[model samples]
Target: MTLQFSATALFAHHGGFGINVNPFETNLINLIIVIGVLVWFLRGFLGGMLERRRQAILADLSDAEDRLTRATAELTRAQGDLAAAQQKAETIRRDGVARAAAVREESEKRTIEEMARLKEDAVADLNAEAARVSDLLRREAARQAIEKALASLPKKLDAAAQSRLIDQSIRNLGNA
Candidate 1:
C-alpha cells in the first residue's frame, strides 16, 4: 500500500470511496482484504480520539486536585480565624465582667457615702435641737432664780444685817 492523499479528492460529488472496484470488486478475497483495511483504519482513528479524551480527563483531574488543595488551605485559615475570634470574644467578656463589677462596687461605695452623710446630718440636727432645748431650760431656770432672789431681797435686810446673817448661817451649817 502506498500513501496517496493527493490522488484521493477529498470531496468528490460521486462519493465513490476513491477506489477502482472494476475487477477486484468481484474477487471474494480481495473484497474481504479491503474491508479489513477499512476496519483497521477506522479503529486507528477512533483509538486516537479516545486517547485525546483520556488525556483531557487526566487534565481535569489535575485541575480538581489543585482546587482541593486550595480549598483545604482556606478551611484551615477559616478555622484559625474562628479560634482567634473566640479568644477575642472571651477577652471582651472578661473585660465586660470586670467593668460591671467595678461599676457595682463604685455604686455601693457611693451609696455608703450618701448614707453616712445623711446619718451625720441627722446627728447634727439632733445635737442642735438638744443644745437649743438645754439653753431654753437654762434661761427659764435662771429667770426663776432671779425672780425668787428679787422677791426675798426686800425682806432680807441691810448690808451689815446680811453679812451677820450669812456668818450665823455658816456657823449653824458647820454644827449640823
Candidate 2:
C-alpha cells in the first residue's frame, strides 16, 4: 500500500501525467536507476546461469559429434562386409559354373566313349555270327554233295562192266 501511495505521489508530483513539464528526462532517469539496481543485484546470477547453459550446449554438441563418428564407422564397416559377401557370392557362383561345365564335358566324353565301346562290341558280335554262319553253310554244302555222289554212283556203272568185274572177283577169290 505504501509503495502504491509513493508511486502515485511521485507521478502526481511529475505534473499530473501530462505533457506539461517534459516528462522524458524524469522517466529516463527513473529507468536508468531501475536498470542499474537490477544489474547490480543480478549480474553474477545471470552470468552463472549463462555459463552453465553454454557448458550444457557444448556437451550436447560433443556427444552429437561422437555419435556421428560412430555411426559413420558402422556404415563403413557394413559396406565393407556387404562388398565381401558379394565377392564371396560371385566366387562361389563362378566355381559352381566351372564345376558344372566340367561335369557336363566329362559326361559327354564318357557318353562318347561308351558309344564307341558299344559299337566295337556290336561289330565283334556281328563278325563272330558271320563266321559261325559261314561254317554252317560249308558243312551243309559238303553233306549235300556227299549225298548226291552216293545217289549217282550205281547209275554211272554199266551191266557189261559189272559182269567182268564179278568174274575177276570170283577168280581172285578162288586163288585166296
Candidate 3:
C-alpha cells in the first residue's frame, strides 16, 4: 500500500520530444508553400517601396549638393566684397597720409614766412627807435649850446661894450 516515485518516469518520453524525419508529420512542406506564396505575393510591393526609398535618398543628396554649391558661391562673393572693402580702406589710409603730409608742409611754409615777416618788422622798429633817439640827442645838444652862449654873452659884455654894440647895430640898420 506504499506509493513510489521514479525519476525516469518523470523524464520519460511518449514519442513527443524526438526529432521527426517525416516531412508531413513536421509540416515542413506546408511551411515551404506558405513562404513561397508570401514571397511571390509581396515581391512587387516590397520592390516598389525600396525604389521609392532610394529615390527619396537621391533627392535629398541632390538637395544637399545644391545647398553646398550655393554656399560656396556665397562664400566667394563675400570674400570678394571683403577684399574690395580692404582695398578701399587702404586707399583711404594712403590718401589721409598724403593729405596730412601736405598740410604739414604747408603749415611749415607759413610758419617760416610769418617768422621772417616778424623779424623784418622788428628790425624796422629798431631802426625807427634809433633814428628817433639820434634826433632827440641833436636837439638837446643844440639847446645846450645856445644856453651856454647866452650865459657867456652876459658875462663878456659891459656897459661901454653894450653902448658901442648898440651904436654899430643902429648904423647897420640905417645903411640897410
Candidate 2, residue 142: the lDDT equals: 57
Please identify which of the two predictions, 1 or 2, would achieve the higher lDDT against the true structure.
1
Candidate 3 ranges beyond 4 A from true positions: 1-21, 135-176
Candidate 3 per-residue C-alpha lDDT over 1-176 given as tens digits, one digit per residue, 9 for 90 to 100: 11333344334634334444556655678789999998988898898899999999999999999999999999999999999999999999999999999999999999999999999999999999999998888768756865675467667898687668657756854774
- Model 3: how large is the Cα RMSD against the reference? 10.4
| lDDT tens digits by residue: candidate 2, 1-50 | 22123445666777566433334534655677899999987888898999
lDDT scores for all predictions?
A: 0.80, 0.79, 0.80
Indicate which candidate wins on TM-score. Answer: 2
Candidate 3 Cα deviation (angstroms), residue 1: 44
**1 or 2, greater by TM-score:** 2
What lDDT score is found at residue 152 in candidate 1?
80
Better of 2 and 3 by TM-score: 2
Error of 3 at 9 (Å): 17
RMSD of each: 8.8, 9.6, 10.4
lDDT tens digits, residues 25-82, model 1?
A: 3355666898999989988898999999999999999999999999999999999999
Per-prediction tally of clashes = 0, 0, 0
